[model samples]
Target chain A: MLTVLVDGVASGMLLFVLACGLSVTLGLMNFVNLAHGAFGMAGGYLCVVLLNQHGVPFIPAVAAAALFAAALGFVLERTLYRQLYGRDHLDQVLFSIGLVFVMSAVVDWLMGARQQLITLPAWLQGRWDFGFMTVGVYRAFLIAVCGAIVLALHLGLVRTRFGARLRAAVDDAVVARGLGIPVTRIFGVTFALGSGLAGLGGALGVEVLGLDPTFPLKFMVYFLIVVAVGGANTIVGPFLAALLLGVVDVAGKYYVPQVGAFVIYTAMVVLLLVKPHGLLARGAAR
Target chain B: MSAALRFALQALFWGGWAGAYFALPEYLPLLAQIAIIALFVLSLDLLVGYAGFVTLGHAAFFGLGAYAAGILAQQGWGEPISGLLFGAAVAALVGLLTAPLVLRGGDLTGLMVTLGIAMMLFEAANRMAWLTGGADGLQGVEMWEIFGVWRFDLFGRTAFVYSLTVLFLLYLLARLIVSSPFGLALRGIKGNRRRMEALGTPVRARLVAVYTLSAAYAGIAGALLAQTTQFVSLDVLDFHRSADALLMLVLGGMGSLYGAMLGAIVFMVAHHALSELTPQFWQFWIGIALIALAIAGRGGMLGLAGRLLARWGGR
Candidate 1:
């Protein structure tokens, strides 16, 4: 039970890393960026290419991948996403769907539609034997890294003046513009930060879930479900929802094999039925 | 008389063009398939374009129809018309059952719910291999002749005529609906539900009705697909089917029934042509085309054509 819980939490942290970015982008921009998953996949493939093909170090490769994802996000925000602002949801959905196809095709063309394996470095190779349970050092690293990121994000949003201005702008963009905040720049920065986090999560997740071209399509639905159940505007909502979904998924797979595939979706349906506004209504509530 | 003659001439010109291509033996089957796809797109456009609902899982209705027809046909109900009705009935039933839950949610929430439902159906179909043929799909579906007069030929000749006739009839029905008071109500609902509610319109009920109606259309399209192809596959339920329907709707121009037909023709032709040229990287070209269309031709091919025509006339 403890093992399952630990594993669930670790998986949940990974989901949170992806869902949080989606939640913020959807809430603040109201832009349904289906290409977000593609960005993450791109990061994963880049990490693999750098490490396996170019013989780059693991840490530097991951960093480079994240930077590349961030830069792409910045460019997408300026070029495509800006035009989509205030458009109807249907337009956004169609445009994003088109973007998804474009990105997936590019990735498939480059990667040859085959699953690539990510090899962790020697320093992160060993396992920690807990007498009854053996856990990989890399899993521990993921949990620690994700925890640190959450902490950093919390501090960045609460303790910094930039965070304060961002919060103000999120509350009322027009009002913030009236008060002289650089709303456009803040939007770009926030998008880049979100994309970077997705890249980092993608890099880490490839080790756990292997890298595949269609990986984004398989996970995009779940990520959207997490974001929907967690509530869009609140940061912590995604964290809670991801953890809940992850645990349910792990447990369902173990206990009930027939209905296991539906566990997360069932949870989402139930949550939406109960709380239409989602679990968290405010960002600070986390 | 002159106005009527002009309208008839115009119709004949376009109809003859479609009929000429459809008369070719090799192209007839492809034309039938495109007609079914066009109908599917038109149904989706009614919801997404006119009603402002962004459903990513419209294939639920399409797949439901296909399975309904296949299952019924396998059970000795060999009549094609009855089979089509059965498919549409199943689709309408499912749509009605889920309408309440779907209508209550916001755009993104509704999208997720529909997607979840579709995925659930897909998983269920895969798991219940006995009933659904376990992913290999239900085959050997034989459609009975129309009133025992015309037999379904092996070369798809009968299927082409049957599908085209149904397509034309449905197109007329869709045109009637679009110009009817119900379509106006749907448009009003799309604009502002609160305002429609204030005006004493049963917004939720109207939405459910429209959704069910659209599902019926999708179901009929699916049934036509099975009837024409004489096989039913789980691919009908796949996400790609829904994505293709969405792309078709967007590429044609939403809210215009003719746009759906135009979009289907263009998309299928592009798909067929591109695949023939580069089998491995065909999807890459299609993807690039979609992005280019979305960016440059905001309103799609029909809209672009309209603009060019207007410009020429103005000049």
Candidate 2:
């Protein structure tokens, strides 16, 4: 049981790392970016390519993956996403879904529709045993790294000037703009940051989650669930939600193999019905 | 635009189908598929365009209808018309049950809830392989002749006739409903919920009624496909089904029934042609079209035509 809990926590940390950017973007910008997983897919594939083909080491490959996705996010935001900032949610959905399809097809073309393999370093391999329980070394590393990211992100959002500006913009974009805050620039930077985090998570998660052409479509729901259940904009909200989801998912699969993902999807529908604004949202219901 | 001219145009529009039945006998299967898709898109228009509920899990109803009909047929009750009605009823019942959950949330919440419900249904269907045949799909679905005559042929002549007739009847019904007091109230609710409620309209009731009706229409479409093909697959419940239906509705013009049909024809025809040419990359082109359409405008083909006509008239 303790081992399961640890595994769940590890998976949850990974999910938070993967989905926190999506939560922030959805909450702050009120944008429905369904294509966020495509960015993760991009990062996952980049990490795979860097490690397998280029013989690059794992850590630097993961960093490069984050940078590459961040740069892609930055460019896409300025050119394409900018045009869609104020569009209706339906439009945003259609546009983002379109991006997902395009990206999926592109990946399929480049990668031959096969799952990519990631080779971890020797130290990251094998399992560690304690007196009470045993845990995978890689999963422990994931928890440590992702917990650090969450802490850094929390501090970045709370302590930094940029974080304060972001919080204000999330509160009210119009008022923030009136106060001469570079709301647009903040959005761009945040979008890039979010995409970068997704990339980093994707690179890390490829080992556990598997990397393939359909990665975006397959995992889109989990990311959305994290964002929605976490309450849109807050960092910690998604963190908690992701942990709950990870635990529930791992436990569900382990306990009731026959039911599959029905439990999670049903829980999400029930949760959304009960708390549409999510558990942590502070504003009036939209 | 006069009543007589409208009548004439309508006759000509359907007349074109009859003409194609004789003229393009080889393409009857494709035509039948297009007709079914058009009906599906029309149902989506009722929800997205008329009622202003943007959903991404409409396939839940479609799949429910298909499975219900397919299982009934596979179980030895292969009567065609009743099977269609049964499928529609099952879908409508499910839609009615889920309507409150869908209406409880805002747009994003609605999207997620509906999607979640659909995914749950998909998972349930996948798990219940004994009944649903799992991923292999429900097989041996033998649809009987329509009204004791005119057996379904491999050439799809019967399928085309059955699908087109269903489409026409439903299209007419949809037109009647949209012009009714209930439909007007739905439009009002879509425009402003508070105002509609203040105007003494039971906004929730109207929405529920229309949503149920839309589900029934989608059910009918799914039933027609199942009956014609004599099979049902899990693809009937897939996300792509909902996404494609939404795309077709947008392509034709939201809230416009005729535009819905036209869009279905165009999209399916393009799909048929494109897939044959570049099967692997077909989705890429569709993605490009969707992005361009979203970026360009929401008016779709009919909107563009209307704009061009206005420009010419102004000139």
Candidate 3:
């Protein structure tokens, strides 16, 4: 049971890294961008190619993949996403889904439809035997990496000047604009940063989540679940939700493999029924 | 816009649709699929266009209907029309159960709820190997002749005619329902829910009714697909199914009945042509089209065609 919990926490942290970008874009920016996973897939492939083809170090490759994805996201935000801000939620959903399909097809053609693998360093790949519970070394590394990302995100959003401006923009774009904040530029930067985190998450998650051309389609609902259950706009809400969900999902598979993936979705629906606005509404937003 | 003009337009539209029977003999199977997909899109049009509800899991009902039909056939109840109706009834029941959750939230919440419900169903069907046949799909579904006279043929001639007839009947039923006062109330609710509520509408009940009805329509479409193919797969309930249906609705135009038909036809042709040209990468073009459609000033292909037609008329 303790082992399951440990594994779940590691899984949850990875999900948080992948889904936080969506949380901010959906909750803060009010944009239903389902293509968020596409960036994650991009980062995963980027890391794999860097590791396999170029013999780059694993840790630096992950960082490089994140930077590359962030650059790509910045270009998209400036060129394409700006046009979609004024549209309704329905349009946004369809638009992002379309973007996902396009990215999936393009990647499938470019990289072949097979799953991509990254060679982890020997130390990071070993299993650590700790008496009653033997945990995967990779999971421990994931938990650490993702925990640092979450901490940095929490502090950056709570304490920094840029985070304040972004929060103001999320609270009320028009009012924030009146207060002399560059709302569009802030939105663009935040969007790129979110995409970068998704890339980093993807690079870290090749072992746990698996890297594939259809990663977006396969994991789109999981990302959405984090956003929906977490209530968007806040890093902590999704962080907690992801942890809870990750535990539930991992435990479900560990204990009762019969019900399979249904348990997490059932839990999500019940949670949504109780709190339509989400677990943390205004406090996290503020 | 008037009753007479509406009648004439409907006649021309459906008449042309039926006229294709003798015109496109080589593509009967494809035409049958188009018929089923058009019905599916029509159901979505009611939920999305008339009721202003955005769903990402409409394929749940579609899969339910398909499975229901396939199971019935496997159990030796292979009658076509009855199988379709049974599938629809099951779907309506599921819709009734799930619509309350949908009504509680706004558009985004509703999307999440519907999607969650669909995913739950997908997982259920996937895990229940004994009942659903698991990844191998629900097979051994043996179908029978239509009305004991016209038998299903190797070339899909019977399938095309049967599906088209079903489509026409369902379209007529849908037209009557949409033209009723209840349909007007749905439109009013879509336009402004608060205003409709202020005027003494049982808003939740009406939404549930329409949602259930739409599910039934989708279910029948799924049943049709199952009967025509004699199999049911997990893909029937996939998010891709729902997304493609939505794409068809958007491409055709929303809020209009004929838009569903137009969207289905255009989407089918586009998918077929693009896949033929570059099978592995066709979705790229579809994605580009979706982005373009969303960024466009208005709605879909029908919307653009409407503007051009109006411009021509004014001239």
Question: DockQ for all models, in order?
Answer: 0.49, 0.79, 0.80
lDDT string, candidate 2, A1-286, tens digits: 8888888888889888888888877766888888899889999999999999999999999999999999999999998888988887778888888889899998888887888887799999999888889999999999999999999999999999999999999889899999999999999999999999999999999998888978887888999999998996668888999999999988888889899899999888888887888878775775
The C-alpha lDDT values of all candidates are: 0.80, 0.89, 0.88
Off by over 4 Å in 1: A282-286, B1-14, B21-23, B296-298, B312-315
Clash pairs for candidate 2 = none
Error of 3 at A2 (Å): 2.7
Per-residue CA lDDT of candidate 3, range A48-150, in tens? 9899999999989999989988988899999888899977888898889889988888888888989887778998877889899989998998898899989
Q: Rank candidates by DockQ, best first.
A: 3, 2, 1
For candidate 1, lDDT tens digit of each residue in A1-286?
Answer: 7667776777788888866777777766677776678778878888999999999999999888888888888898888888777776666766776777777777877778788887789999988889998777887888898888877887888889988888888888999999999999998899988888888788878887567877777788778867877886656777788888777777777778877576666676667666666788652421
Q: Rank the candidates by TM-score, best first.
A: 2, 3, 1
Off by over 4 Å in 2: B1-9
DockQ of 1: 0.49
After aligning candidate 3 to the native by TM-score, how far in Å is the CA of A184 from where it should be? 1.8
Error of 2 at B165 (Å): 0.5
Q: Per-residue CA lDDT of candidate 3, range B235-260, in tens?
A: 99998889999989998999888898
List the pairs of residues colliding in candidate 3: none
